[model samples]
Target: MNILFIEDDMIESMKFQRTLSKIASRHTIIEAKNGEQAIDALKNSESLPDIILLDLNMPRMSGIEFLQILKADEQYKYIPTIILTTSENRADLLECYRIGIAGYVIKPLKYEDYEQKLTAVLAYWQTNELVKA
Candidate 1:
C-alpha cells in the first residue's frame, strides 16, 4: 500500500512512520509536512496514494482545507483519506466526516498503540475492497 501522511510535527511524524514500518514493512509511506506539501506530493506522484493520513492543524494549509480541495477534484475525489490528528474534539471529528473523509483516527502517543491503529486502518481498507468486489 502507498500511504501519504500529512503531519506538521516532525517528531510525531517520525514516530508514526516507525510504527507503520513495523506493522507493514512492504508498504510505501510518503511524508508531507502540511496540506500544501501534501497537495504538491499528490500532484507530482506518478500514482495516487491508496490512503492519506491527514493532521488537522498544520501550517500553510489545514487538513480541513486539504480535504475540501481534494474532494473537489475528480482525479483525487475517490482516493480514501483518514484524519489522523491529536484532536479528539467533536467539532473536528464531525467536520472531517462532513468533508467526506474515510476515517478519523486520534493520534496515539504509544508506538504499540499506533501500530494497532495502523493495522486496523489497513484491515478496514481490505474489508472495504472485499465488499466492493
Candidate 2:
C-alpha cells in the first residue's frame, strides 16, 4: 500500500517508517516534514496514497489546517485520512472526527503496541478496499 506520512518529528517518523517497512511488500511511504511539504507532495504526485497518517502539531501549517484544505478540495477529499499523533486529547479526537478522519490513533510508547495499531489500521484499509471491490 502507498502511504502518506506527515509527521514533523523526524525520529518518530523514522520509527514508523521502519515498522511499516516490515509489513508492506509493495509499500511506498511518502515523507513530509510539515503540512506545507505534504500538500506540495500531494499536488506533485501522479497517484494519491491509499491512506494518510497525519500528525496534529507541525510548523508552518498544522495537521488541522492541512485537513481543512485537503477535505475542502473535491479531488482530494475522498482519500482516506487518519490522525496518528502523540496527542490523546479528547478535543483533538473530536476535531479529527468532525473533519471526517477515517481513524484516530494515539502514538504508543511501546513498540509492540505501535505495531498492533499499525496492523489494525492496515487491516481496516484492506477490508475497506475489499468491500469496495
Angstrom error of the Cα, residue 95, model 2: value is: 1.1
Give the deviation of candidate 2 from the true structure as CA RMSD.
Answer: 1.7
Q: Which stretches of candidate 2 lie over 4 Å from their true place?
A: 130-133
Query: Which structure among the candidates has the greatest lDDT?
Result: 2
Each candidate: what lDDT? Answer: 0.85, 0.86
Task: Give candidate 2's whole-model lDDT.
Answer: 0.86
Model 2: per-residue Cα lDDT over 1-133, one tens digit each: 7789999998888778778777755567899988899999999999888889899999999999999999998978988999989898899889889998888999899988998898888878866963244
Query: What TM-score would you give candidate 1 relative to the actual structure?
Result: 0.90
Q: What's the count of clashing pairs in each model shown?
A: 0, 0
Question: Candidate 2's error at 54, in angstroms?
Answer: 0.4
* Worst-scoring 10-residue span by lDDT in model 1: 124-133
